[model samples]
Target: MTKDHYWPKALSKFWMDNEGKVCRLSSEGDLVRGAPAKFGVVGNHHYIDLEGPWSHSIESSFQAADDRISFVVDALNSLEAKPSNEEMAYMKRFKAGSFDSKSKNDFAESIASLIVRSPGFRHKLTLEQKAFRNEFLPDLPFRDSNDLKVLELRNIQIKYPEMIASLRASGKIIVMFSDSREFIFGEGFLQDIDGPNPLLPCKCFVPLTPGMAIAFVRPSGPYFSMPEVVTIQLTPNEVNLCNEITQIYSRRYIYFRSEQPVISKEFTDNVYYFLDYSKHPWMDGLLAAAVNFEDN
Candidate 1:
């Protein structure tokens, strides 16, 4: 059989099997339930749920799977260049660490180091590692409210129900919120709402007053050295699109239509490409997706 024909089939089968198995492995924690040993007054009972632990385990599994997928993809793309002995050893270490059956922290530093050494995956992995570290060992010292900007909104109402409905129908809009910032949209927002809604399918718009928005800034600290602000902006169409894309693709790999430049030659050649590409496909995509906005 030809390489092209065989390879596609192989890839499809591999992806199918791995995706299912990974999903199942990640969900194993969820299958087990926890029951509390004590009961509460007024016919109320308390139980210590294992959901949190289960969720953590699932998240770890997903991260490991993602890392493995990236490595495989990179290897496939570089079929012409066989891996060196050292590289093969590193790959083995990575595979072992991914399923080490220990806490994510146990393998985080090593995996991060390995990922940084690749030119294709450094940026994405860096972002993922940062998020993981933040979740596990939040740099509380970096969380100062002084740098945050607070905004308020009032007298907000839904205006364009039709538009909202259309977006929801197309799996675009999840949830719409009116805030001090333009508006905010979150994934699966619409689906989570339980009630008889009167908003039109495509014409509904969530309205807001001046005090509805809030912007929080990440304070300067060792963990979060750079200052960043998160603004809640929601518009019917924008929310729909954002939610749709987020649902369809992992946030790390999704590219949005924004003013922010996806990539720059100076940024890519100097910083990004030199890092590991196996874990940072998004970075590669970013560089590839960049347009010469300067000309336009």
Candidate 2:
């Protein structure tokens, strides 16, 4: 359409498909799968746009982090709160570059993405990402360019198997990875079978690499349907083991790719879980609208 061309009225926003690809709902009812949409879950809504089609798409949750320097600007303008001169200056630089031009990288190796992989993108950090790290972590060990340069460094995935093993390593338990899908965290990796029923037919444990875990479940129901997810606090050793596992597996994924645009920070978690059910950090339908990504 030209500048003065009449355009059809339609909704052009983001939504998730059966698989977790960020799809762009075009104005003409066309299903163009795999549009790159940056998402800020939790309580963050600082939209940081750069170049390319990526700049055109953004999704923020209701409870998005209030860390955008712009928020401060709005509040100050609206008489919400006051910042010192230094604070104002920092806010200027922060907004110009991003909420967090130089902040800690708080993602575990199991879930690390552009902030750790792509320098071009990491050079531009998001505001929500900044808040999450500052709130949860005091300092990040791997932020320097030289430290991130160690591309071979594999962040551990999980070390929970040992702890779980110590306490009933073979007990039947529901493994709720997220709010939408419910899979039993079976005791050992058994994903050779991708069943028709992802919620009810999964029978094996998820594969564990560094940062990932290899749990051994003692099946409660040989034919169990959807499982429940439990929150387990891991010990130092267990955490270390998970990272060890994640390191081995992170290598398998070298890029942040979707259907068409191939975005990042969306799929650094379990590759099997994503490929198995199209689950991305930002692609959950309900989550895309409500709640935020898990507190991992």
Write down the TM-score for model 1: 0.16
Clashes of 2: 38
Compare the candidates by TM-score and give the number of the best one: 2
Each prediction's TM-score against the native?
0.16, 0.20
lDDT of 1 by residue, 179-259 (tens): 212221111111111111323211111111111211111111222211111112233333334333222221111111121
**Model 2, residue 218: C-alpha shift (Å):** 10
lDDT of 2 by residue, 164-217 (tens): 222222122211112111111111122211212222322222321111222212
- Model 2 has an lDDT value of 0.23
Model 1: lowest-lDDT 10 consecutive positions:
147-156
